[model samples]
Target: MEQTEITEILNRPYARELLGRDLTRLAYVAADGTPRAVPIAFTWNGAQIVLCTTRNSPKLPSLRRNPQVALTIDTEVHPPKILLIRGRAELDDVDGIPEEYLQMNGSYRMSAEQRVEWEAEVRSLYDGMVRIVITPTWVKLIDFETTLPSAVEELVRQRAERQNA
Candidate 1:
């Protein structure tokens, strides 16, 4: 998809809400040739989606082998709002916790004391982390209002045709 189209979709209010959400399902091919989708914390930095993980994360190898990935951020409410994104993962190894990691996790509800303890624990546990960065190449937003899943859209069109007939 064109960059402009992606930007427009992402700029939509619903899509922006999904992007503000803390969790997204990162989907990629596993090393064993199976598809894997796992919930991970992420931050959307205007131009890229950044997910931080341990340096030794199992998904690291798989991502290195196949950088292509898809991410889904959606709501659980009826007639859900979903933002789907496809991109190529670019791994960046950085010393210490990435700011994006801290920023993303900050959304979780925690008391000030609890937040301090958690930050300490996180800092002490990992000396470095890998930033799994993805610059979205394609995007789709399904609000079930202005948009929907492609198959559902097609079905709606067919139903309309039948009604007209």
Candidate 2:
């Protein structure tokens, strides 16, 4: 898709809402040549989607081997609103927790005291982390109202042609 088209899709209100969501299913090819999609917390900066993981994370090796990835951020409601993204993962190994990691998990409901405790625990747990950054090269939004899955859209077109016939 053209960059402008991708940007237009990402700028839609529903797409923006999905991006604001706490978790996205990150899909990638594992080292064993199998597909894996795991739900992980993420933060979408206007241009890129950022995910953080422990330094020793297994997925890191898989991602390093095959940087191509897809992400799905969707709602659980009927006629789910889904934003699909395709990009290449860029791993940045950092010495300490990235601020984006803190921001991504900040949406969880917690008391001020619990929040403080949680941060402390996180700080103590990981000596460093790997930041996975993906800048969307392609994007799509499906609300099932104005848009739909490609197969469904094709079926709709076939039905219309039959009616015309």
lDDT of each: 0.97, 0.96
lDDT of 1 by residue, 34-123 (tens): 999999999999999999999999999999999999999999999999999999999999999999999999999999999999999999
Please give the lDDT score for candidate 1.
0.97
Per-model TM values vs. the true structure: 0.99, 0.99
For residue 48, model 2's alpha carbon misses the true position, in angstroms, by 0.2
- Between which residue pairs do clashes occur in model 1? none
How does candidate 2 score on lDDT? 0.96
TM-score quality measure for candidate 2: 0.99
